[model samples]
Target: MFIESAGNSLRTIPGSFAVQPTSLQALFSKLPAESLSAGQTLILEGDVATSVFHVVTGSLRIFRILGDGRRVITGFLHAGDILGMSFKSHYIYTAEAITPVTIRRLSRKSFENEIAVSPDLGPAVFHQMSDEMAAAQDQMVLLSTKNAEERLCSFLLKELQRTLNAGALQTAVQLPMTRLDIADYLGLTIETVSRTLTKLSSKGVIETAGRHSVKILKRGKLAQMAGDGDEYEDDWRPATPQPERIRH
Candidate 1:
């Protein structure tokens, strides 16, 4: 079923501009699921990245495990977000699931074979890679800032943008991760994170829609607080730096 039409919809995916879905399916057909449980390790630093993954369900975390064994959450993998970054056959970070995950795994040889067979898929994959790199760069800029409130504001703004459509922005976006997760992602203390949200709400930039939800009322103010100048709307950033290199 995955092979039928060779992934017509995959090529059309917003970031997957280069994936020749048909070829991806052809290559993916050779690889199978590893049946990962919740909290399973999918890949780790310094290990050969011999496989690629397409998440079927559940949320996956791509993060760096520090020397002290603390996890720095990089990003979450939902139903989309292809998990493949090939560099000298080694993975820089690791992938684990916040919940039980099912991923379609493809070995490097087979993964590359599909690209070898179909020239179009390579460019498509390259586009997707570039997009991911751009997003990562933006994340670095947010993390690099010394201000925790600024970082938290940026994180919330980004999330809200993701939930918004072109018409009118929603009152709030649903937060999938908890306050601790937000703190970890923003490199802030939980209390600080909570306070930052409170400040934003008090300023009328955002109003609490409900528990685990937020609605934007004064987006312009939120943008100012995030240190992102207000020219673009709907979470558009003036600039997000690209990561020159990410340690695997």
Candidate 2:
């Protein structure tokens, strides 16, 4: 399932996951659950991919460090997303909890065994991987073609759409990640993000409720600025409410 917003089809939202097969959910429920505080490291880049995690709650930042020690955020994961599904021996990026998080850890060996025997599990994993690739393609376009304001508009609209999926009120979009996190994820500087948002607010396109929330005064205007066309003009809601998709 996917959430369509402003012409972008997002397979999952921040607080919800794609529909898990009943068997899979049961399997996850039987696994051990672990909790981590905010800023805790869940997996490090280059570490052996020994476990796959099912996020039960909270948000995580997926990123990699450059040779010069710069951090590039690949994406953000929320509840219902899975982590450490690498085919390679090591994880490609580091995952850390940006908020307090709970996860169910499944050994890679067990995961592979289940996929081999469970008819539904393999297809679900494949679908998730495909959805991830599509999101990555969207991010590539945003970075290569969009200006700072356009990028911010797209990000904000996407956030609103994600919140809508979790059945939250459409009045305010929640942003759990900080500006620095947004900057890294969007490939812009923190100053640029702040400036662009301020610019939008001046135009009455959106209003910042606080550090962590935004209210859309003009959804169509914001969507237009995002270059997503008039798809958002009709209804502010998705045709079918879908669980959240992964950002990285």
Candidate 3:
């Protein structure tokens, strides 16, 4: 009972959520699909948390603006990610489309009511909240301990895993967000992000393809530089070096 819409399956990663997709589809499919062009705001911080959005395609940047006008990007959301999980009345962060995106919206009130009555849905949504917290903890560790180079390396590897999870190539990682977005997310300056990428390229761990894509030339080396060591070494290693190819 998978949630299928527009030829895409909205399935969570195994062990993350025990969702009954048939129920999820029934819960959300009646809602109309929403389309957002790149750079469009999907959810603004401090707005009433009226609904949650399920990403059908493309990417979004989740961030919060500080009182002094600085922005801190909390994370980037890709296909299958959900936003507006706050327990509070107002959203804690803003979600903006980084690429042309398609999503489905479900009112939080309706969602809460349904989950409260549905035994299976209750546990699934709880797991979803736990997953979000784990990701936030990981981001905190990345910012607190990692250097500029390590941060960028870790980011590329993360994007690589996301690419693979989407059933795409293991070596080519697409970065739809701008360097400034990455800088904000990782707590570094845009110049530092550029310089770190350049440094990685010189080391032959990665190569930039056009403005938005990167080819992982040496996964083992990049993972090593990321300092993940055995934690992700096996999962991050590439099967074989393939010819360079860039997607337009």
Candidate 4:
């Protein structure tokens, strides 16, 4: 009886505990918690948009399926990032919890009602969306870069800084996304990404334990290794050849 009680008390991911926006807090004061397990398909591309989710805990991996049915991981969304952004069209990509997740469910009707009432929310959401777009442009540069090491380094720096800005501590940056997801997102093969990570670890720039655990030890050296260590504008550009356009 005691053990079951303790187990039941475990915190569930995606619960109402994650909702933090001042306006959302007022709306879902009575909202209940729910769970989304890792590797479970939460949504599919083209699924009709009905409800949106507010991640209460855990991480979500966003991926899109190619025509050949291969899943390409676009990015990983951590706690508090909005999942559904499009209303005119359905979800552009599918999202799955990479870890156990909990979320507060918001119906379109409820969200619209709130927006209608609160003029502040619309601008806030738009600002968030614009920020996401700028991040995407950064990724484009990473993707097009020819140097594998440069690309890997850029990815690490960006990933770490992003999480730190989102409430994670600097010394210890948790990689909620899998290495394979990182490789795929950066356009590197799994083996290459693994090798690069091992190299960086051995060189004392980072300390990696297993796949998802990463501790950054030397920030300056890593930025240098990626050619971005120098403050000069020339060093920021990738040293490798440009990627060729793949005709779809």
Poorly placed runs, candidate 2 (over 4 Å): 1-24, 243-248
Candidate 3 residues 81-119, lDDT tens each? 666555678766677779988877666666667777787
The digit string of per-residue lDDT tens for model 4 on 1-248 reads 00000123323222232343355434444567567677766666666665556667888777788999777777776655555545544656777778988765666556665666566666666666666777778777767764899888877776666555565544566787777888778778889999999999999988987777787777777778776856423212223321111000
Show the lowest summed lDDT stretch of 10 residues, model 3.
239-248
If scored against the real structure, what TM-score would every candidate get? 0.72, 0.86, 0.82, 0.78
- The per-model lDDT (C-alpha) reads 0.60, 0.73, 0.69, 0.63
Across 147-222, the per-residue lDDT of candidate 1 in tens digits comes to 8877877877776655543223345576756677677777778899889888888888788865578887776777
Which residue runs does candidate 4 get wrong by more than 4 Å? Answer: 1-30, 166-170, 231-248
Write down the lDDT that model 4 would get.
0.63
Q: Which lDDT value does model 1 have at 68?
A: 98
Q: Total backbone clashes of model 4?
A: 7
Question: Candidate 1: which stretches are off by over 4 Å?
Answer: 1-38, 165-171, 209-211, 234-248
lDDT of 2 by residue, 1-248 (tens): 11111122212212222444444445466665666778777766666666666778998888889999999987888777777565777667877789987777666677667767677877767776788898889999999999888888999877787777777756588788999999999999999999998989999998998898888889898989998888587356643566434322
lDDT of 3 at 19: 49
**Candidate 4 local lDDT, residue 169:** 41
Task: Name model 3 segments beyond 4 Å from true.
Answer: 1-26, 233-248
- Against the true structure, whose TM-score is highest? 2
